[model samples]
Target: MEKITLYYFLVNNKATLGLGENIKLLLEDAALEHEYVRLELDEAWNNKKVQLVKEGLYSGTLPYIEVGGKKFGRTVPIMRYISVKLGNKYHGANDEENQILDSAADIIGDWFESAKLAFNGSNEDKKKYVEVDTPRFLDIFERYLSAQEGPYILGEKISYSDFLIYHRLDDDMALDRLADYPNLTKFVQSFVERPNIKKHLASLSK
Candidate 1:
C-alpha cells in the first residue's frame, strides 16, 4: 500500500476553526505523526494547484484526505474518515448511530453555507442571516444536543464530528446565536476545556 496523504486550506478569518485545522488538532491530540504543509495563497500556490491536479492530488475541493487507497472530499465523509482513522472510539457504535451523526453533519454543512453568506454577502443579506438563519439552525442543534446523554455529541464519547461542530459554533460574529442555546454553548465549552484538545487549540494560536 502507498503512504496516506491529506491536504486542505485554512479558513480565512478563523484559521483554527478550519476543517483542515480541526484534522490537525485531532492528529496533535492523538500524538500522531504528521506534517502540515501550507503555501502562500498567491500566484505560487495557483501554479502549484495545477501541479497537484496533474499529480492526482488535487480534487478541486478541500478537506481532501486519502488513506489506505481510499479518498474522501466533503464535510461528513471527511469527518467519518478521520474519525475512524483516529480510533473507533471517535466514531459511532453502529450503523444507526453513524447515520444519525451523518444527519447532524448534513445540518452543519447547511448551517455553514448560510454562515458564508454572512461573511461575503451584502449588508441586507447579512442581516437576514443573523435575524433568521442563525436561530433556525441553532434551535435544531440545541434540541439535538440537549437530548444527548452528556457533554459530547455522542454522550460521554468523543467523535470527530464534535470538533467540526465546535468550529461552526465558535466562528466569531457569524454564529452568535449559540449563546441562546444552553446545550450548544455547554458543548462548545466542554470541547474547549478538554485537556488534550485545549492544549492543541492553544498551540494553533501561536
Candidate 2:
C-alpha cells in the first residue's frame, strides 16, 4: 500500500476554519503520517479552483482536500473517509454508531453553511438569516447533544464528530450564535485544549 498523501488548499481565514481545522486536527489526532501540502489561494488559484470544482476535484470551496491524488470535496466527507481508513474509530465502532456520527456531521455542515451566509452577506440579510434559520439549526444540534453523554458526540470517546462540532462552533462564534449551546461549548473546550490541537492552532497562527 502506498503511503496516502493529503493536499489541503485553503485561505488562511475563519470561513474555512471549521472544515480546515477539523481535517487538520483529525489527521493529527489519528497520528497518520501524511504530508500536508497547501496551495495558498491567490489570484492564481481562482481559475484552477474553478476548474477543479467543475471536475469534482474540489467544491471550488476553501479547505479543499485531496487524498491519494483523489479529491474529497467537502470537509466532513473527507474526515469520515480518512477516519475509516486509518481505523481511528472516531466515527464509531458499529454500523449504528456510524449512522449517528454521520447524522451529527450533517447537522454541523448545515449550520456551517447557513452561518457562512450570515457572516458574508449584508447586515440586513445576515439578520434575516440568523433570525429565520440559525436557531433551528442550533436547536437540532442541542437535541443531538442531549442524547449523548460526553466529552464527545459519540459519548465519552472523541470522534471526528466532536472535532466537527468543536471547530464549527469556533468558526461560527464570530457570528454570535455559538455561545447558545452550553454542551457544545464545554465539549469543545475540553478537546481544543489538547496538546496536539493547541499546537496546531499555534502553528497556524504563526
Candidate 3:
C-alpha cells in the first residue's frame, strides 16, 4: 500500500502516454492506486520539478517512477515491478513463461524504433518504413498471435506485452494498415474492450 508516483510530460492538457501510458493502464487494470506528476517538456530541462525528478529518481528522462521510496525508469521494468508487486497476472506464470513474455515485450520495444522512423522521418524514409519495415514487424506479431490460443498474447492470458503491443500499433500506425492482419486487429479490439482498460482509455481522452 505504498504510494506510487509517476513523473511524465503533459501536452495540451493531456499527459503524453506513449510508453508511460501503458503503465498507467496496467495499474488501473490491476486496480492499483497511484499518483501522476505531469511536466511540460518545453520547460522541463530547467524546471525545478523536473530537476527534482532527475535527482530523486536518478533518471534524466520522462516517465520516471517512485514506489516504496525506490525509483525506477523505463517502461518494461516499471511494468514488471508493478505486476510483480500486484501478483499472479500480467507477467507470465512461470520462469519459462516469463522469459517468453519478456522476449515478446523486448520485440515490441524494438518495433518502437521502427515506428519512430515511420512517424518522424522524411517522406521517403516513412514510405520505406511503412511499406517495408512495418509489415515485416507486423507479420512477426501476427504470426505469434495466430500461433497462440489467443484473445490475448502468449495464449489466453493477457500479459504486459499485449498492452505494449496494442498501444504501439494503434497509436503509431494507421488502423487501415492492419487489414491484412486479422488476428492482430482482433487482439486490439478485444483488449480495448476489457472493462478496466476501456475505462482507463476513456479517462485519457479527457
Query: Candidate 2, overall lDDT?
Result: 0.70
Candidate 1 residue lDDT tens string, 15-111: 5545576566666556666556543456777776676567675465566666665555665566566566556656789887777677777788788
How many collisions per candidate?
0, 0, 0
Off by over 4 Å in 1: 1-6, 10-14, 65-75, 172-177
Ordered from best to worst lDDT, the candidate numbers read 3, 2, 1
Better of 1 and 2 by TM-score: 1
For model 1, give the RMSD to the true fold.
3.1
- lDDT of all the models against the reference? 0.69, 0.70, 0.77
Give candidates' CA RMSD values in order. 3.1, 3.5, 2.4
Task: Provide TM-scores for the models.
Answer: 0.82, 0.76, 0.87
Least well predicted 10-residue stretch by lDDT in candidate 2: 10-19
Q: What residue pairs clash in candidate 2, if any at all?
A: none
Residue 115, model 2, lDDT: 82
Q: Model 1, poorest ten-residue lDDT window?
A: 1-10
- Candidates sorted by TM-score, best first: 3, 1, 2
Candidate 3 lDDT, 35-130, residue by residue in tens: 977777675356755666656655567577888787788888888887877675788878888887888888888888777766777899888987
| lDDT at 1, model 2 | 16
Model 3 / residue 171 / CA error / Å: 1.8
